[model samples]
Target: MRDLIKDAIADLKKGDGFIYVTADGSKIDLHDAASKGIAVTPVNPKNQVIKKLEAAGLHLNDGKFLNELNELISLVTGNGVTSKTSKRRTFSDAEKSKIVEEWKKVEAAGKKTKAAFAREIGVGYQTFINWLRG
Candidate 1:
């Protein structure tokens, strides 16, 4: 049983899917194993399907096995881990000083709060505060 489970995991790692046959002869398809939906089953501690998969290191939540499966899928599909990359804006020292000076003027005039000023200048409130601190 352990060997079977290990072999299944190995196959998944090699970008191949398998169908697990339960002791009762029911079939559980592990196609697209990287997907959470593919691993859904009733939370029964004695469910052979779930038990075997869990024993093989597959967890419903994010876990090492799932990560491996995802990596394999990414390699096979040519869609590596999808991450959102934001373009960071860098301000020069002169630009920073100028913005700070303008903020000071606004502060003296009591026209707008720092958060509003930050919004007006297209920066986050926390980022603006950090700039001011610097």
Candidate 2:
């Protein structure tokens, strides 16, 4: 019954002409002279067809109904997630100063003919001198 009324409404709109429907045992023409659409007023207020059409029209006009329909669509047709991990580390300023001080000692020793100190620290002599200046 609902689908029939839905189709009838669509057809009436497409045809854009008078559609005769029995309203409470009386024949009446809906949208008698409309150019773009049809409008039918059923006489029996409690008729099932009239109730269904009214309900459908009300649901179509409601903002909350549209929001709920959108939510249902998103639930049924959503995409999956992807990874979002970072790959970097942070160090404190104190830690950096300690490392620089250790390098400066080896560099100062390497300059005073203890070239083996720089080699033992696994740093080039020039690199050690650069570290000592900081």
Candidate 3:
């Protein structure tokens, strides 16, 4: 990852604007290395500098832009980024089975009325209908 970050820095120093593709197929504007605070005057690649980052396992993907610049800088400068953590719950096997079973019943009913399906599953009709479409 460090190698990727260093390569990005080198590219940025060379006056290249990083191109990032958003999940929705939109492009992101990442202008320059100087703007991102990664020094690149004269824009030359340093082998020793790259080696240090590579050894530390810091890497970024091509065209990801400076959204991760602070993180990379923290890795290189020994002061990593800090943030709060949160826990998330995944659906249990029983829950998954229930949803599938509900879907089956909804299909088997033949008429497939929104109200009927919602009543069968004990959820709001609108919510059940939206879930079906989603």
Candidate 4:
């Protein structure tokens, strides 16, 4: 892991972005070393630097470097990186028909489109349109 960090620093110095590989062989772009505050100026890759980078790449491929980096980032930023997830909503056929009927009533009463009625009823315009399509 230390070797990987060192290589990452060297890579950053050379204006090259570090590519982190996971145990599953997925590649993630970690940007440059400067962005991670590991190094600043570009440096020529010497024998020592090359060896360090190769070690780092191995650690990255094994998934150790990424976990450590994530932990470090969470410690510094106060929040760990995470993906967002949302629950899917399901509507019944009867509910869809009722909503379409209500939309028609709103349209009869001077509402320009079903979008306004959808907003009043708390459904998204696209969702309402999809319901209408059925």
Candidate 5:
């Protein structure tokens, strides 16, 4: 609960860009598994920073702490997150054509996958695929 944020900060600073399984509590930090929640909300690993966060409690936030959480979430999840947010982003037809054309070069190079490219362009795989549908 407490050490979570600092551990996350450390994890973020490492920026290895991979989140591992936390259920076993081995070889992975909470933020490392930020999958969607951007939370390591399970481990109560007795981190000193967590203890400090508890001691300096705001007493207003029910239970959640960290004004820095938002920044942390963005860093952890950012555009690389696997899931999409609720809102739909509309792209122009020209933009769609451009993306599809670029993907052609990437596909020809065989160095990357459609999914990876879609992530790079900040679009979902399905959305990217739909552009190629026609």
Candidate 6:
């Protein structure tokens, strides 16, 4: 929701970012909560985020930005994943060729650039170019 984005940005502008809004319409003062509690574990925001989205008229099945909303929430709350995976993603030669073929087909249709196509397929632009080169 645009409201959510604006709210998140406004919270950023507020500086310290102690306030967090949850799906239940509850506002949390993070520092206060942590101070009062013995310990705190980050709550998974998936369900709550979706609930908020639904309340704002966006749904999981029909025309929604679930991943983007989650990302924005993570950034606003400073709860984004900070660790990288030990293993890197790899695709086989056949997969690379298949992706390149699809890219070519899209290009032939004059629809999008390698970067746009890469984003559409959720891969890095450089990786898509490497696939195209082969």
Give the alpha carbon lDDT tens digit for every residue of 49-107 in model 4: 45665654533322345556566787788885543332356778898898788677667
* lDDT score for candidate 4 against the true structure: 0.58
Candidate whose lDDT is highest: 1
Over 104-132, each residue of candidate 2 has an lDDT whose tens digit, in order, gives: 66557665333444444434566545554
| C-alpha local distance difference test of each model | 0.63, 0.49, 0.51, 0.58, 0.60, 0.63
What's the CA error at residue 69 for candidate 5, in Å?
15
Ranking by TM-score: 6, 5, 1, 4, 2, 3
Please identify which of the two predictions, 1 or 2, would achieve the higher lDDT against the true structure.
1
The TM-score that candidate 3 achieves is 0.24
lDDT of 3 at 103: 77
lDDT of 6 at 75: 79
Candidate 6 residue lDDT tens string, 92-116: 8898888888777778999777776
Any idea how many clashes model 5 has? 3
lDDT for each residue of candidate 3 in 59-116, tens digit (9 for 90 to 100): 3221133235555676789875544332333555577467657677657867666575
Ranking 5 against 6 by lDDT, winner: 6
Error of 1 at 9 (Å): 67
Which sections of candidate 6 miss by over 4 Å? 1-87
User: Which structure is stronger by lDDT: 2 or 3?
Assistant: 3
On the 0 to 100 scale, the lDDT of residue 69 in model 4 is: 58
CA lDDT of 12 in candidate 6? 47
Worst 10 residues of 5 by lDDT: 58-67
Scored by lDDT, model 3 comes in at 0.51
How well is each residue in 33-126 modelled by candidate 5, as lDDT tens digits? Answer: 5644543334333343345445666222221233244445767888434333434679999989998998998799897888878876768888
- Rank by lDDT, descending? 1, 6, 5, 4, 3, 2
Cα RMSD, each candidate: 19.5, 32.2, 19.0, 20.6, 16.1, 16.0
Candidate 5: segments with Cα more than 4 A from true spot = 1-87
